[model samples]
Target chain A: MVVYGVALLAACYLIGVIAGDALGALIGVQANVGGVGIAMLLLLLVSNSTSIKLQLGEATASGITFWSAMYIPIVIAMAAKQNVVAAVSSGWMAVVAGTLAVLVSFALIPVLSRLGRGAPKV
Target chain B: MALDTLFDSLVELLARNGLITAFLFVGLVLALSNWLSKVVTRGQVHGSAVAIAAGLVLAYFGGVATGGSKGLADVGLFAGVGLLGGAMFRDFAIVATAYGADLGALRQAGWVGALSVVIGVVLSFVVGAAVAVAFGFTDPIAVTTIGAGAATYIVGPVTGTALGASSDVVALSVAAGLTKSILVMIGTPLVAKRIGLDNAHSALIYGGLMGTTSGVAAGLAATDPKLVPYGAMTATFYTGVGCLLGPSVLYFLVAAIL
Candidate 1:
């Protein structure tokens, strides 16, 4: 199962990257199929965990949605790169942006949750 | 001129082996994502219709990685096909609770962990996009690094839910934050130099870099066990310092290059 999962991940990545470009070209926006897949996987694992139990279907759907939304950062990052077109064409910038987005979001979670609590009364 | 050449070279390389490059890039991204999810789901792990969707991504990248291209029809077919992993790992707590497992009371804790991953992704992406837009450029790569730093440093422990050592997790987050700073300090300057940006202009690249790292550090320190609120105050302080250091060095390097 583990090996299968790993294989599946690898395969998905390749398709996401290659097809993303062709798709991106047609749409006039850089496509990050790999980014979306990873995001989906992340959500998939999170949702499935006996620990979270967000419900399989809901978690799966949300996972995709959240990951797709996460792509915004990659778009922004490429735009910020020295050559946006080349960056998108190469897709390295997207990889870097997507990785960083995941990391930053993961880190801030605790702090945000704490802050989400109403301030303690004096 | 040098930047242009490098960019041109990258473009050429990509164009020549677009399929291969795409596969490599996607493979790494998914692999990294898997590792990260392990940290979150602890091996618990995607979609239906979504299933074919994932398979299409798989088939396309796989074909490209293997030195070929999938047909448009195949790609479309794969996108619609979906897979279901049977069991949902996230609901472990609830399942246990129903069975009256000793840990049944901890379901909310599990939910916390799940929420951390979901919310973390959303917040960082939005913030990152805003930051990029403010800079008048949107490079997905930069936003990713900053967002990951934020997620790892800030959200890691909150998402931990006692599945593991919070202290250890916090320490790991610290390591990650430091890594972010170092990567930026080094990466920005190299990129700046490559692009022929004058030394004076490099600072702009480093600004958000620091903000991200510090945010994570603060989250880590704030959640650690050793520091009472007062001690954590110190952690918070350190986080600020770390945050400040990342961009500061980036700016200095940019300035030097320009």
Candidate 2:
């Protein structure tokens, strides 16, 4: 059952990758466009569908949940692969760009918060 | 002589199946990180944050030891780490996070949350690109890549790879994104009350604007456990938004400017 979930994810991933490439070609970008995002949308659609949900059963659903929580480890693997020292040594641009972006974004949080103040409560 | 042969065979076997070895090694790192988070930091910082820091350190040493570009994966025993941390699995893992989201809940966040996502991406891009210019990066590709990195780490590399930026530039974008993530993780709770990040509505907006799921999630967990899901929801969408916009519209915009 767990394997079924993995199979489903693999299917979504493949489709997402294909669609992303197609989109990139269509736009003349020469690269996959939002493959991860497309795959996520596909997964959300398949899992939330009532008919597919019935077929998935509890075991398969738990498998998906298990992998979803695997984000932490996957992220760790990603971090480990990055060359932080080289990036830092390349120039000051990386550090400056990152810090400035975050600081500006953080400062704007209050302004954005105010924009939503008048919305109706759900 | 017999014991030496046994050890060599064991090493060869692990080298042959690097993925399994990588999984085991990462598990150890995470186990240690979680412990450190609990004991040393007293849970003030999330375990994943600590784990990432450790990972970066290990990667630095791995490169120094092997003189290779792929970091620890360049070592024979951990070769599977290359595939495990490669684009395929990274995208797969990111997509899987959408499993827990409820579509209905997203709709409840309203137009404000959606607005925040767009504004967040644009604002971060502009700021990052400006800083890149100030630092003398004249190339549009480099500017766009770093700008996208400010949107999120995922967006940075995706844009870089798509645009054919050099490895060093891509690495810089990653560093930029990582810095943003760590900052958001540490700063969220400290400024949560001051920024009025108390309710699910505000959390949704915050997530959209911040655009780093891990940072927003961990920060909200420290602020209020119930708000993590709400913040993470929009933060997930923020990545999607950034990925779509980064290499296309954002790239073109930077090209026009510089």
Candidate 3:
């Protein structure tokens, strides 16, 4: 049953990759565009759709949940493998650019929050 | 001599099955990180963040110890780390995170939440690109990659890879993203009350504007556990939006300017 989840994921990933490649071609770029993100959106749609959910059953649904929780560990592995020393040594640009982005983004929060105040509560 | 032979064989066996070894090794790291988060930081920092920081440190030390470029994977026993952390698994894991999101809940956040996601991605990209230019990075590819990194760590590398930017630039983008994640994680609780981040509505906007799911989720957990899902929901969409725009539209915009 868990394997079914992986199968579904694989299907989504392949389709996403193809779609991304096509999109890239359409836009005149030579690489995949948003394949992972597209795959995620597809998964979200399939997982939420009543028809698909009914076919997937409870066991397969749990398989999806199992992989979802795996995100944290996988991300940790990804982070651990990055060459931080090299990145830091290359220049101060990375640090400066990142810090400024966060600071500016943080500053904009209040302004965005205020803009949303006019909308009625959902 | 017999014991030494057995130890050699064991190491070789593990090395041959590298993926399994990586799983075991990362499991230990995760366990340790979770413990540290719970016992040492009192959950002030999420376990994943701590694990990532630890992984970075270990990678630095691994590179130093081995005098190699591949980091820990250069060591005989940890070779599987390379494959486990490769782009294939990374993308797979990222895509899997969307499994449990509720569509109805997304609609509840309304149009403002949607606007925030777009604003968050573009704002971060513009600021990041500006800084990249300020630092004399005239290459549009590099500038776009770095700007994408400002959107989120995931977006940065994705953009960089798509644009065929140099590895060094990609690494820089990732570092930039990690910097933002840590800042958002630590800064959220402190700024919560001041920014009126007390309810689902504000949390959704906060998630969108921040756009780092881990940071926003952990920050919201610290602020209010109930708000985590709402913040994380929009933040997830933020990554999607960033990825879609970074390589295509955003890259063209930067290329036009430069």
lDDT of each: 0.31, 0.76, 0.76
Residue-level lDDT of model 1, residues A12-119, one tens digit each, is: 444433553454355333222223223233334443567645333443444333323322122111111111122123233333443464345334433443432333
DockQ of each: 0.06, 0.47, 0.44
Pick the winner on DockQ between candidates 2 and 3: 2
How would you encode candidate 1's per-residue C-alpha lDDT over B67-108 as one tens digit per residue? 333212122222111111111211111111111112221222
TM-score of each: 0.23, 0.76, 0.73
Off by over 4 Å in 1: A1-93, A108-122, B1-60, B63-122, B134-258
lDDT of 2: 0.76
What is candidate 3's lDDT per residue for A85-116, written digit by digit as tens?
55455467777877787778778777777777
Off-target runs (Cα >4 Å) in candidate 3 are: A109-122, B1-5, B66-70, B108-118, B129-258
Q: Per-residue alpha-carbon lDDT of model 2 for A1-122, expressed as tens digits?
A: 88888889888888987887787667665446556556766887898898988899778877677766765676577667655455455467777777777678777777877777656766
Q: Of 1 and 3, which scores higher on TM-score?
A: 3
Number of clashing pairs, model 3? 0
Could you tell me the TM-score of chain B in model 1?
0.23
Record all residue pairs in model 3 with backbone atoms less than 3 Å apart, i.e. clashing.
Answer: none
| TM-score between candidate 2 chain A and the true chain A | 0.81
> Which sections of candidate 2 miss by over 4 Å?
A113-117, A120-122, B1-8, B136-258
Place model 2 in a CAPRI quality band: acceptable
RMSD of 3: 4.9
Candidate 1, DockQ score (0 to 1): 0.06
Give the CAPRI rating of model 3. Answer: acceptable
Order of candidate numbers by DockQ, starting with the best: 2, 3, 1
